[model samples]
Target: MKLIIISGRSGSGKSTALQALEDVGFYCIDNLPAPLLPDLVNQILRDPDHPNKLAVSIDARNQHSNLKQFPDIYKRLRETRRLDCEVIYLDSSETTLLQRYSATRRKHPLSDDSQGLQQAISYEKQLLEPVSDLAAIRIDTTRLSLYELRDSIKLRVARRQEQELSLQFESFGYKHGIPLDVDFTFDVRCLPNPYWVPELRGYTGQEQPVIEFLEQQPEVQQMLADITGFLEKWLPLFEKNNRSYITVGIGCTGGQHRSVFLSERLAGHFRATMDNVQIRHRELN
Candidate 1:
């Protein structure tokens, strides 16, 4: 059986992720007690018609002591060779979490009359530290829209098999800030810039003008080889340990040209070699 344990702070879109998993046919259970997990798995195993896929939603609402015991339970579950378990933790920036709570007018799970919203958010983060440490995949949902979040959960989470690694090569601009969820980030601002050319200033890396300009730069080829070689050497180590996701961020001064081209080239090369690969241009979108 394959189990996906979804845990996140309040308002970080765990509900949406659970919904997406359910839509994809996982039998989902919400707020399951940490102690009951073993029993549940055993019961499912005994049943003849049990769905092979299971998703469980866990959060800070569990008793304080129970939450502390989670790591041991998770360790035992992992020890059982019959089950393949992956933990996904979703997180957002404090500013984004505050904004979301304000927009929805919903009480945070940790908040009360004595606690301020910020205090509640901080406490929840501290409270969930054990589970956070065990997460095989961590997603930053601060910048995701409802549609994008749903799509990500469907594409990156539900679709990936237990043994498969979902890889993403993303392009971003330095001025905009780095992507929080990527496992590795490469800065390619030193490479030749298509923006220097008057005619290619407005075109993105996907366009022929920008692509041609970048293709002619020998430094760009060398950079790609170095980065690709490093990933090739280390990525299988992550996969062998059952990593569910790997995100590589490629950044330039502006996301429109060099970064986008390299991200495309790297993703294209790996897609043919890997099970699931994705490419995203953050600034371009």
Candidate 2:
């Protein structure tokens, strides 16, 4: 069975992700006990009409003692032959999480009589580190609207069926912090600065003007060629090692101009060569 374990902080949109997976025909479960995962897998395996796809959410409500055993359980599930397991970890900034809780007036799973919302958020992040560390895909939902988050869940999780490598390209600005979840990151800060031009400053890299400016730069082409060539040569090695996903990050001074241009271009090049290539602009989104 193809299994997807969706886990994250309380307000990071785990419920939304589970719903999206269900919409796409995954037999989805939420807040499953940490230890019961293997039993569930075994049950699915023993069934005559085996389920083709399964998704489960490991919530923060799980006992602290049980949470500590997650590492061993996650490792065992991954090693199981019949279980094609992929971990999707969702996260958001503390400020955003706080805002979400305040707006919705929802109590955090870890929050109680003694703990405040902020403390609970911090404590939950610490608590969830074991599963988060094993995550094949870490999605930072700090900027995503509910609609966009659902779309991302459908696009990323639903697309990877079984033993398939999903490739993603993310563009970010150096001004913002680097993305925590990526296999490779290429900083194209040396590329032509389209933001310097008054006409193109207002436009983003997806627009024709910014694209044209970056395309005209010889060094930008070289950087793209080198990065693409290296990935083309090494990607098969990762596949051989049983890797399921690879994220290529491209960054510039600002995500709006050069980095975004390169990301779109690189994704365009690889889309012809592979089935599951995706691109995300961190600053723009």
Candidate 3:
């Protein structure tokens, strides 16, 4: 059986995630008593008619009293059955969580009625830390829009089924700086400034005029040539290391022109040869 334990700090969108799982055909139960999880799993393992995908939510409602028993239960479950268990811990910033709770007008499960929301948030974070650490996947939902979260979950499910290497590119402006989380970064700031050219000032590299001008430059040609060869040589090593997603960032002085062009060109080139590729320009607009 495929068992997934979904837990998070009180207002981290666990309920929303559970709903998404249910929509995807998972047999999901929310706010399940932690102590019942072990027995539930055992019974399902013993039963031939049980659903293949089972998801359970555990949170502040029943977690504090039963939290201490989790480690042992995890160990016992792992030892007894041929089961694939995954823990998904959802997390969001305290401010975001507080807003979510206030917006919903729901009392915090751990709150002392008069306790400030921040204090309750702190307490829940501490309480959920252990199980969160044990989770195979941790999702930080602070900055994710609902659509983004839904798409992220869909990406995870698709990747699980395909087991293919995923490649992502985030193009950025040098003025805004390179994306902090990029695995690979390229500086196109040294190339000719398209911002200086009045014709290309408002137009993006995706346009034919920008492409034509960029193609006319020798430096642009040489850089893409070298970068492509370098990526082809090293991409296999990343795959061998079992990387799920590789993010490459291309940056230019303003991010409006050169980096945008190169990023698009590189994405097209890589997609033509590689298994999976996604590209985004952070300042293309």
Candidate 4:
């Protein structure tokens, strides 16, 4: 059986991710007690009618002591040769989490009259460290819309083949905060800026005009070659190390031109030799 453990702070889109998996036929449970994980697995394995894919959400709502015991429980689960388990931890910036709660007018799971929302958010981070440390994939959902988050959970988590690394090339604007989930970040701000050209300003890196402009710059080609070469040399090592996912962040002043173009080029290059390659232009969406 394949088990996916979904966890994160409140308002970080954990519910959306769990729902996405459930939509794809994963039998999902929300707010499951951390201590019951072993029992849950055993029960599922014994039942002939059990679903092959199981997803559960465990968060700060669980008992503090139970949450602290997660690491040992996870270690034992990993030792079970027949059971395949992956933990997907979702988080967002504190400000973003605050904004989400305010927008939705929902009560935080750990908030009360004595402890404010901000304090609860901060405390939850400390409380869930055990589970977060065991996560195979950490998703930062601060800038992702609900639809984008759903698509990401479906494509990056649900559709990924077992033991194959799900590699993602994401482009973003430096004006916006750097993505927290990326394993590596490349700054392309030093490269030529197509946004300066009046005609190309309106076009994105994916467009022919902007693409043509970037292709003509010698520096752009050199940067692409350098980044591509670096990944080519290192990616094999990560695969050999049994990595399940890798996210590379490429950023420019604005996501429209340089970063997006480079991300597209890199993804294309890796896709030629790798499976499960995906590209996302954050500002575009």
| TM-scores of all candidate predictions against the true structure | 0.95, 0.94, 0.68, 0.97
Residues 9-110 of candidate 2 have per-residue lDDT tens digits of: 999999999999899889988999989999999988999898789999996899988889999998899899867887899999999999999999988878
The lDDT leader among the candidates is 4
* Greater-TM-score candidate between 3 and 4: 4
On a 0 to 1 TM-score scale, where does candidate 1 land against the true structure? Answer: 0.95
Locate the minimum summed-lDDT window of 10 residues in model 1: 142-151
Look at candidate 3 and tell me the lDDT of residue 259: 85
Q: State each model's CA lDDT, in order.
A: 0.90, 0.88, 0.76, 0.93
1 or 3, greater by lDDT: 1
How would you order the candidates by TM-score, starting with the best?
4, 1, 2, 3
In the range 131-238, model 4's lDDT, one tens digit per residue, is 999888899998889899999999988998888889999999999879989999999999989888898899999999999999999999999999999999998899
Backbone clashes (count) for model 4: 0
Would you list the clashing residue pairs of candidate 2? none
| Range of the 10 consecutive residues with the lowest summed lDDT in candidate 3 | 154-163
Q: Where is model 4 poorest over a 10-residue stretch in terms of lDDT?
A: 75-84
Assess the local accuracy of residue 18 in candidate 4 as a C-alpha lDDT between 0 and 100: 91
Pairs that collide in candidate 1 are none
Q: Write the per-residue lDDT of candidate 3 for residues 57-134, one digit (tens) a residue.
A: 987777475876777776776576667676777888777898999899998887886777789899887777657766
